[model samples]
Structures are given as C-alpha cells and as structure tokens.
Target: MSEWMVTQGSTARRRARPLSPLREYLRDTFWFAPMAAMVSVFVVWVGAQALDTAIVEALRDEGDYDTLDELLRFAEDAKAVVSAVGSAMMTFIGVVFSISLVAVQMASGQFTPRVVRIFVRSRITKATFAVFLATFVLTLLVLASFDSVDDPRAVTTVPLVQSALTLCMVALSLLLFVLYVNTTLRLMRISHVIARIATESFRVAASMPVSTGGQDDAARLGSATAWVPHEGRAGVLRDVHIARLVRVARRHGVVLRLIPRIGDFVVPGMPVLAVHGGPVPPRRALRYAVSVGVERTYHQDLGFGLRQLSDIALRALSSAINDPTTAVQALDRVVQFLAALSRRPLDAALHRDRGGAVRLVQPVPGWTELVDLGFTEVRMCAIGSPQVCRRMLAGLDDLLLLVPPERRQPLLRHRELLRQAVDRSEPAPADRAFALHPDRQGIG
Candidate 1:
C-alpha cells in the first residue's frame, strides 16, 4: 500500500520550488533594458573618464599648451550641445515609444493581445529603448564632467573621451530609431505579423526532436500517481525546465510525466506532474522545472503561432472588418505552417536520457490536434468567403500530398468539412461547385 504513494518522505513537510519570478520578469518585461542601460552608462562613463584624465595629464606634461587651450574651448562649446541632446533624448523616448506603444496596442486589438507580448520581447525594441536612455545618460555625464571655467578646483582640462562616447551613443540612438520605426510599421501589416509568427513556429519545430514513428512506451505512464501540486500563483504554463527534469529523473532512475501540456492554465493545488515507474524525487526540483505566467509564450508552445495566425484570420472575417483579403493572407501562413510540418517529421513526446532510456514523457500535440487547432475555427468563419474557402481547400490538398498516407485522415476530414461548409454557404448549385474547386491563389 505504501508503494502506491508517489512520495516516500513526509508529504506535508516538503514543497515544490516555484519558478523564479526574477527570471520570468527578465524574460517578459519592458523596463529591464532601460534600467540596464542606466547601469551600463555609468560603467562606461567611469572607464572613459579615466582615459580622458590620463590623456589630458600626459598632454600637459608634454607642454602641449596649444592643444589644451583648443580642448578647453571645445569642452565649453560642447556643454550646450550635450545639454540639448540629453533633454531631446528624454523627449524622444517619451514621444516615440508612447506613440509606438499605442500603435502596438492597436495592433494587438486588430490581431491578438499576443502582439504586445511580441513587441515587448523584441530585441530591437528593447535595444532602441536601452540605447536611447544610455545616450541620454551619457550626455548628462558628459555635461557634468565638463569643468566649470569658474571653478578653481581639480579638473580634467579636456573631457575628450567622454564627449566622443556621447557622440557615438547619440549616433547609435538615431540608427536604432530607424530600426524601431521600421519594426513598428511592420507589426501593423497583417502579412508581416503572420510571417513572423510562422517563422517562430518553424524555429521551435526545428529544436524539437523529429518523430519518425511511434512513442509506444509513452502511454505506460497513464496510470501514474499525480505527485507534484503547483505551489505558485495560478497562471498559464509557459514552458517546462526540460533539461533539469530529465537530469533529475535520470539521476533517480525514474520517469517523469508532465500532467499539463505547455500553454495550459495551471492553478495552485493542481498536479504539476505525475510520478511514473519509480519513487518521486525531491519535490523542489520537480516544481522549479515548470514556469507559469499570466499568459502563454511561444518558447515551447507550438500551437501559439497557429493560434495567433487564426486570430488574425478570424478578425479579418468579422462583420465589422469584412476584409476577406486579409483573412486569405492569414490563411496563407496557416497553410505554410501546416505544410512545413506535414513534410517534416513532427516532434516526439518521449524524451530520453543520455543512456537512451526514457526519462520523461511530455504531452506534445499530435498531428490531429495540430490539424484541428490550425484549421477548425478558421474553417467555420471562412465558409462565407469564397476566397478563404478556395484557399483552405487548396491548402488541405497540398498537405495531403506532403503527409504520409496514415496522416491523411485529418486532412481528408477537413476537406470534407470545407465541402459541406461550401454547400451551406453557397445555396446556388453553380456557386457551391465553384467554391469547392481548390485554388491556392483563391480566385486566381
């Protein structure tokens, strides 16, 4: 009877370790970069100021009086320019990002709220903000380093190095602004959004192990004991710490099965993982392996990309928007996502240890689930648009050729559903028949 219990030690005493909020904060927040920029500016200022002082001292020793006078004049003149540049950057940050953020909010509304997340996580967006702040700080430091010609205090005659660093930062800030504007503009374009999401999906797919065939032993863990309960704030399961879990499981010579799929909402007290084939190891290790956040991320959740694409298509098909053209464009990427995976081997669920023994069984989405997730909602909404209808049919047909025969069932079922939807959408015999014909380019 004791053997049936997943945990061997006292259950009440041990608790699972919650994933690090600091790690998640760094991963998902917008302010980290700008805050980091402040620190970076100070560090650079220290080093560059030292160099400037050393160079000034050496020049004075060499009796370079003419160069010293010129540098002093330049430093005096640069004060106002640096001051203006510093203040202008502050205004630039507030105005540019405020407007861009508002635009991002609009894009999120038009597509999915995921757009804002994508925007926040963008390296260019972060870099632009960081550099802008760094430049502003650099200017401020440069201004401060300038000697008061009125001061009878110890002062570096020429703040040449600090000024040069300021100029470089200012130039970089300008270059990054161009990139930020371009990226923001691209976010507003539906085609670009879809392409970006699809590109991410492909990147995730490329990391996952390609499935040749069966994960036969995967189901052996079905009757396993649910051992670990979530100990943190309830939210969407973002991703699992796969390497850690596998390492721990291999050490214990046990198999760990994740109970919830990535992207599933997990609440406190929910079973995080099931212990299969052996005694549960330390609860802390298992608990720390999972990350839960307010919303889903694309890191390990393959469906998120398709979900975003479908959302765009659905929004385009809405009665208010009634933009079938945009809907068709969204469907283009949906087809591309399915088509890419159709030919390539899908991911395997059973994660193996270095010794080739099964250590973890992840609940990866099967082809059927992927098919349903990719096409189901759009199919229902797309019926009214002949453009969408024809494109979907053509897409299913293309997937049929790419997938193996055993994988053909779902595609055929979707094809049949589309035919039925066309029948219902086009009451006229000729119209229904025309809509049934597969065309990748919609009407063309």
Candidate 2:
C-alpha cells in the first residue's frame, strides 16, 4: 500500500465519540427506545390536562351551557373507551412484541445470529416499540386524570382535550400495528433479510473515508514506546476516541500508531499503541481513548458488516439447510459490497496534528484482504450447490469488470479455485459445465 489521506479536517476539531461504547449500547439494546417513550408520554399527558382545564374555564366564562353539556357527554362516552384502551394497550404491547420476538428468533436461526443485532438496530422496530409504549403509558395517565367519573359524590368535570388525545393515540396505535405487522412479516422473507444486511453494510462502508496505508508514517517515526492497557480485561476492540488520541499524542509530543485494529482482540497488559519518541502519556488518558466489548459491532468495524453478510450465506449453504438459492442471494450482496468497495481507495487511516504532521496512524483492511474475506469461504462452501457455484462465478466476473487491472488477481485466483471445486465435486460433465457457466441469477 502507498500513501493515503484519512481525514481532511483539523485533527483537534475532528469529530470523535468519546462515549462510543455507551452509544453503541443504546443502538443495540431493545429497552432504551421504549424507556425513552415512557418518559416522554408523561409530558404529553400533562400538557393535555393543562389544556383541558384552560378550555373548560374559558367556556364557563362565556356561559356556553349547550357546548359544555355536549363536551361533558362526549367526555363521559370517552371514559369507557379510554379505559378500554388503557387495558388493551398493555396487553397488546406484550402480545405484539412477544410474537415479534419469536419471529425475530426464527429469522435469526434461519439466517444468522447477527440478524438479531440487525433487528434490535432497526429504526422501524425501535420506533414501533416506542410508539406503542407511549400510547399505553399516555392512555393510563389520561385515564388516571379522568374528571368525568360516574361516582355521585365526586365533582365532575369534562376532560375534553384528554379525551380527544386518548382517541388519537388509539387511532395511531392501530395504524402503527398494521405497519408493525408488515415489517415483522417482511423480516421473515429471505430476500428482505439479506437486502437489509447489505444496506447496513453499505452504510458502514460510506462512513469510512478513502485511504491507502499509514505504515509509511509509522516507519519514519522509529524506536517507539508501547502503551499497554491500564486496566480492565480483554475484549474485541470496538471504538477508538481518535480526537482524544491525537490530542494526547500532540500534548506528549509523540506519534501514536494504534497497535490493534478495530475488531482485533486485546488482552490486559497488551500494547494498545506504540508511542514513537517522547514520553508516554498518562495511562488513564490513553485508556480513556479506547473501548472494548464482548462482541464486535458495526460502529467502527467495517469488516463486521461483511462478516454478517457472509454468515447468512454460510448458514444457508450448511448441510442441514441445503439451500443454495439463499446462499446465492447472500453472495449477490457480498459481491455488491466488494465491487463498490473495490472502486474506492482503502488502506490505513491517518490522524494529523495542527501542523499537518501525522500524529496517529491506524491500519485498516486492504483490498486484497477484503477480497479474500468476501470470496474465499464462499467458494469453498459452494462445492455441491451448482446454483451457488454459478452465482459465485458470476460475482467474480462482475468484480473483475468493476475493479482495475492491478486488483484483478484476487478475483482471478478465486475464479480458478471455483472451477477446480466444480470439476472435483461434480462427476458428470454436464453438471460441471453448468456450474462453471457464470449466471447472475444462478439457475435463472
């Protein structure tokens, strides 16, 4: 790899997520969205109550007896409906998500465990959960503040605004229920599942800036000191506070080359970065710039998206499933990601100081490694499935056309291996010839 530009902005002003681990947690967990909705529901309920009181007072000043009687009668009618919503909404929430969870589980099993992460990260799933929670909680709050009760001793008042708001919530809930069901059903279909994963992978790829490699900078800054983990156990490295690391390196008058790439596992006491010249920064400062988790995430790990796409393909190609068409579908996405990625420059990252001196260097996957990751395993697993074999050949041929001549070797190598696999697996010349033929739609 040659030289590359990682960031165009001033290193000090560059965006950084210091609390990325916590942010990632918010993205992956199921409870946070509904919890936020529960809190917001109270605010909406309070505003409705205040509005109702103000309107009632205004009506009484004008002595609008007929209008007041009409509103009171409507509120009385709404009480029964509101009570029904309060009871039904909670039960509905439990039942709906329960079934959704089961569906999610079956999809995950059918595709890959990574689909569960995608499910939790889905914007629709989160929004549906939040709205349902808001509707349920808001209805309860509206019910508790009901002023037009049936008790004779109780002073009666019409909660006009509350009644309307309650009805609106019910209507929205029904509308969202339809949408939720549609979304849940789509999740079960194989095509939609792979397409969704591919879409997410593209998002991750777009977030990454074009680069070549930062090893040249690291080479110039020789004889470095190592900064090891300050505390905590080992985990798969997820996020790095890049701005903070640059700041620390600048302050210490040293260059930092991150030792482990994102998604690389690091144990305690292992070197996190090599401090090239100058004294090492405080342990806490360096430690604070890094975060580790039990599992890999798409937050910064670009390969994680490919890993997920590949997992689904592998699962479909498994002996138990024996579903080559599904594998072909996954390969279609994998090829798309690879083809798009190949057209861009990808190597390592560079973080520079205010003076334009490279202060931090982080290595990323090169094109060769990425090509291997995308095709190597799939080619091996495509043995008995002629449809998958044809699709893999088509994917390689498509990539060869999209990428430059220098990047064609990886594709060509996979091509040879694929042909050999077909020759070895299929004894009949007709089947082997069919498998060797490149078909984008597999058998189609």
Candidate 3:
C-alpha cells in the first residue's frame, strides 16, 4: 500500500509540469489552424457559385443551351471555371481564418484545452467558411452563362469579359484575406513578446537580496515555530488535512517589511520576520512567541508572493488592451517585484560580538523554551484572517490561565501585553463607520 501511494504521488507530480514546447505548438496548429482552413474551403466554394449566377444573368439576354448536348458541354466548362476560382479563394480564406484564431488565443493566454473549446465557439472559422462558399457559387453561375453566347464574334467578347470579371473577383478576395491575416498575426506576436518580457522582469526581481546586514542579521531573523489550522475547508486545503500557519511573532511585535509580501517561498527552518525589542525573562514565552511568529511570517510572505505572481500572469493575458510593447513593460515590473520577494537569504548573523571575542548566544531558558513550544503549537492553528487572528489570541489568553501559577505568571503577563497591543492596533471604530458611509467623506 505504501509503495502504491508513493507511486501515485510521483505520477501526479510528473503530470503537473508544463507541456513541452513541441507539444504545445502541434496542439495549437492542428486544432486551431487546420480547423479554420477546412471551414474556409467550404465557404469559398459556395460563395463563388452565387457570384457566378448573378454575373451570368446580368450579361446574357436569354438561356441558349436548351438541348442536352449543349447543356452538358456548358456544365463541364462552368465546373472547370468554378473549381479553379474556388480553389484560389479557399486558400486566401484559410490564411485569414488561421491568423485570427491564433491571435485571439495568444492574447488571452489560453493555450489549454479549455481555450481551444472557446476558440471554436468564437465562429471565426465558420464565418470565413460561409463567406468563401457564397463567393464561389456566385462566380460559377456567371461563368456558366458566358458559355451560351451564339455568334462567333460574340463568343470571343463574352468569354473575355467573363474571364476578366472572374480574375477581378479572385484578386479582391485574395487581397482582403492577406490584409486581415497579416494584422491578426502581428497582434498575436506582440502579445507573446510582452509575456516574455514580463517573465524576465520577474526573474530579476527574484534575484535581489532580502537583507544586507552581516552576521548581525542572523539574530534579527525570524523563525517558523508551528503550524496553524485554516479557517475554511472548501478550497485548496479543504479535506486535504493540511492547514496554513500565520506568523505569530509578527502579530506579537515583529514584522516583515521586505518584498514578496507573504505567501511566497518559505522553508521549514527559515526566519520569516525580524525580532524587535522584548523582555528577557519568561524565556519560554519569548521563545514560543518567536517560533510561532517566524512560521506565520513565512506563510504570509508566501501568500503575498503568490498573489504577485498571479498578477503578472493576468497582465500577460490582458496584452490586447494596449500596445504589446507597453504591456510587456508593465508585466516586467510585476515580475521584478516577485523576484525580489523570493530572493530572501537565510539568517546568518546570530553570532555578532559586542566586543573582543565572538561568543555564542545561549539557547532559550527552559521556561521560555516551554512557552515557545506552546506558541509553536498555537501558531500551527493557522489563523489567516484578522478576525481569526483576534479569536485565536483571545482563546490563548483563556488557555494560559489553565497553566500552573508558576508557569502561568509569565504567560499571563505576555498575554496581557499582547491583548493591549491588539487593542492599540485595532482600527478606530469611527474609521470603520466612515468607510461604510462614503458620503460622510463628502463624496456625492
């Protein structure tokens, strides 16, 4: 059972990777372009026949091919002309259809199965096909009429005029198709160029350093202390048995002001927030707070980083709203932001010496260590929203009372401090009221 489970997990991971470039190209080309071409061919054939009929009636006074023999000969001749003209028209229409489909797909960032379905529904393929068919039918009708001209001299003039008209129609169709195709293709290429630019910008942002301090920085670095339960169970983590932890230390006193915001890259042992001024005793409480806070901060940073990445992806999809180059530049900025967030370094400055020789900082005291352990467990509670954070903190305050008096004294003190901080941090009720009543701000 264990082996099977492991194999299944490995298979899922393999499936998650991005499709190969060759596979992507083939899928798009075969599904989108070829489908459009087929539709265009059918349309061109119908259109030529319709145009041929109209021209024939306009040029000829009456029907001359009354007998079966004359009618058969005229039919053969007309078929030849229609087939020739329709083939050329189909080619022109196919090019335009293919271009338009590719352009829309590129702009939308929908290089997936779902996107393909939407493209088919857009009807560019069907519309082009219909137009080509109409043109073909019209051309064939006109060519058939010319075959009935009686006088020898009239024969030369009528056929000559019909051929000229047919050529004109074909030329116009080809010209229109080429122009449309070129415009669409250019737009699609522009969108792709913008996406590439945005990707590069993100890479640059990720390369920037998160801290500049030498060994001193390590002491300031935060620590991931515990896991927390998630608020809801309907989405990504629902029924998954995993929860997202918040930075408890961040809430207590420390805060992360670096890039990537939160919810980005976070490893188990990384420091996620900076430690601020605090009491030395109740070492256990401090340790617990620090550990929980560090974990929470990392989780928050990870979330923020992921959000930024999503924004960049969205910008790529919206390239058609403006010039492709301009969009690319905007996306580049988003990418840079993401890069900066992900480039944070591990803490390496915990051993800074105040004077002569460098000395190791002592491990947190036992009492403080115990407090830190409890804090770690609480942090794992995964309080995400501000409301949840408030609730969790409130619950911790009540729970601390259950601890024996000796242990509880320090914790109770810290809990009171945390409560006071939360009170001070809460936005003023008036501010909330004002937000709800925009008119109070003098807005019409």
Candidate 4:
C-alpha cells in the first residue's frame, strides 16, 4: 500500500470505531475510577511528604507555641485520624455504589434496558465513584507515612496539613453524593428520557449533509462491476467514513456504492460495497473505512435515537406494562422530532470527495421511511388502547401541519391507519368517533 493510503486507513479506523454496548460500558467514565484513585494517592503522598518536611523545619527554626503544640498533638494522633478517614470512606463508597446500582436496576426494569446506558455513561456517577475511591486511597497513603518517620525530633514528622486536606475532600464527596441522588431521581422519569432522545435525534437529523439531488456517476458502473464483501465478524454498521471512501473511490477511478446504510447489520461474506472500476482499493483500506459493532450508536445513525424512543413507547403500551400516559409522552416527542426533520433535506444520499466529484452512493432513509419507523410499531401496540390511538392521531395531525406538501401524504396515510385501528378496536360508534379525532388526552 502507498504511504498516503496507510495514513488514511489509520485515521479512518480511529474515527469509525463501532461503539457497541460492551465497548461503551468498558469505555465509560467509571472505568477510569481506579486510575483516578492511583493518581490521587500518588499526589497526596508527595504533598504529605513535602508538608511533613516544611512543618518540621518551621518548628525547629521557630520556638514552639500553642499552635505548634496543637500541630504536635495532631501528628501524635495521625494514625488514628488516617484510620478513621479510610474506614469512613470505605463505607461511603459501598453505600454510594449500592444506591447507584439500585437506581440502574430499577431504571432497567421499569423502563427499557437501553435506558441503563444513560446512567452508566453519566459523568456525575463516575466522578462520584472516582472521588470516593480516591479519598480512601489518600487516607491509606497518609496512614503509611506514620512508619516512614517515627522520631519526635525528626525533620519530617508533621502530617497536620495532609489530614486537613483529606477532611475537606470528604466534605466535597458528601456534597457530590447528594447531587448524585438528585440526578438519579430525575433520570428515572419517562418524560425526561424521551425528551433527551428526541433532542439528540433532532440534532443528528439536522447535521446530515446537504445534497444537490445529484446522481452518482458510479451507479451505472457498479451494475456490471465486481463487489467487495465484508470479511470481518458480524456486527451493526455504526458509521462510514464517506470522505475516506470517496478518496479511495476517486483514487481508483471508480464509483463505490455502499450496500448498507448506517445501523444495518453485516456479516463476513456479505457485500460491503460494490465497485464500479476494474480493480478495487486495498481490502484493508476499504474495511477500515467502515465501522461495525455489536449494537448501534446515535453518533451517525439517525435510526438509533428514534428506535430507542419507539421501543420505549411500544413497551409502555404492551399489555404487561399498560402505561398509555408514558406512551403518549413518547409519541409527543416523536412528533417533535419528525417536525424538525421535515425542515431538513432528507435526500442527501450522494457524497463527493474534495473535488466535488461523486464517488460514494449510499442509501439513507427518506422521510417516509423514517415516519414509518417512528410510528408503525407504536401504532400497532396502540390499536386496542383509546388513549394511545388518540395520541398517535393527534401527533400525526400536528406533524402534517408542520411538514411540507411532499411529506404530508405519509402523515395523512398514518392518520388513516390510526383511524382504521380505532374503528376495529373500538366497537361502539361513539367511543370510536372520539378516538378518531385527535385529542390531548385521547378522549378526555
């Protein structure tokens, strides 16, 4: 391979790492807790040693006063103080972790398993655990200093300053513990989770590249050309490096059509992309240009966020859960996300290189497909529930007003489907009529 190809391959691999759930869990902030604790312990030990030297020198140079006497007393009781701090910190760490684990378990059970990812990735939770562990490590280090210098007349026997600093840290940890509790409570709510997902999906939809409705020159070329199959393990397609793929395509003087859009699963022996030109780019270079993972991430996959909220709503509407209110809230957010999407260009599937030459042609779901993904499953689950049916109809009607003329047809179609669902599910004409019309509370 050429030097530039090697450089591009490395860079693409770095950017296109598949953020699967296990990878995400291992990469979460809590995983760094031990490193934080070790660093804290090292710094605290160095600082304590320096302070011990300074205090001993000050006492030696200056006559002993009442303040000096108090310092001496603390030094004498340094082991006890360190022991107490270490013990207390250990207890606090256990309590905090227990509470956090309980919250995660409750969220996973009551909500969706996907919701647990939010808590695991929480900065507050990670910082809480890191600080708590650091405090314990610092105390143990301070406690070890007692064996280093045992003579009262020594020039490195004072530990008052270190003890005071550790005490202040304890206070900070306690404050963080309170804030963590508040965050846990807020995250447990269904509305907050749906809103967060909606906001993120909106941002992702808006960030998609704009296209000029240009056709790929390689589209015709790929029909008779050789295809490049994925040679890696099976996984979800998380991201694609369009720029690098374009560069490779341009360099090879051919058009490449990616077989899978973001979030689709691909396995070894499946075609990853089809080549238009005779010879394809290096296999390693092309493989590095795409990211595959065990699960999907919202980074570049537009379907992921919508799928999460839809799944949550569908679960809520299930007979086992039977929480129509939660489903309604999720539908409300879905409507907001669809409205935001309608304003953006959803047909930007053609990607070009730096020279504005189209080299990559991949399929992105049009607005209609997205609408179907967001509403289809939820509507099916809501067929028997008047509250859910009303909410879905109202959402579709509201979306129809916001969407452009081209997009309004799909919304209208979904609305009719919802109306039919109400007709079939509600036998009484009066009850069915009430649900067929969009109402805030589905009849109330």
lDDT of the candidates, in the order given: 0.78, 0.78, 0.37, 0.75
Q: Candidate 3: TM-score?
A: 0.26
| Highest lDDT against the true fold, candidate | 1
TM-scores for all candidates: the values are 0.88, 0.88, 0.26, 0.86
Provide the lowest-lDDT 10-residue window in model 1.
1-10
> Candidate 4 — which pairs collide?
none
**What are the runs in model 4 whose C-alpha is more than 4 Å off?**
1-29, 57-69, 76-81, 147-151, 214-224, 441-444
The 10 consecutive residues of candidate 4 with the worst lDDT sum are 1-10
Q: Report the CA-based lDDT of candidate 3 relative to the real structure.
A: 0.37
The residue-by-residue lDDT of candidate 2 on 1-444, one tens digit each, is 011112222222434445466778888788998899888778877888888877767777777767777776677778788888888888878878896788778877788887877666777778777888888788777777766444322324567777787788778878878887888788888899888776666655655544444556556778776555536668988888888888888888888888888899988888888888877788777766888888887666778777877788888899988888888888888887887777676667787878877888877777898888887887899898888888989989989888999899989999998898789888999988988999999999
- Candidate 1 per-residue lDDT, tens place, 1-444, comes to 121122213332432233466866786777888899989889989999899888878877887767777777788777877888998999989967796778777887777777677777778888888899889888878887888763323346567888888888888999999988898888778778778887777656555554444256775555775487888899999878777888999998788888788899999999888888677888776656888888877777878888888888888888887888887888788777777666554544667778988787777777888899889999999877888899899989988988889899999999998898788768899899888888988888
Candidate 3, residue 251: lDDT: 31
Two-way lDDT contest, 1 vs 4, winner: 1
Q: What lDDT score is found at residue 234 in candidate 4?
A: 95
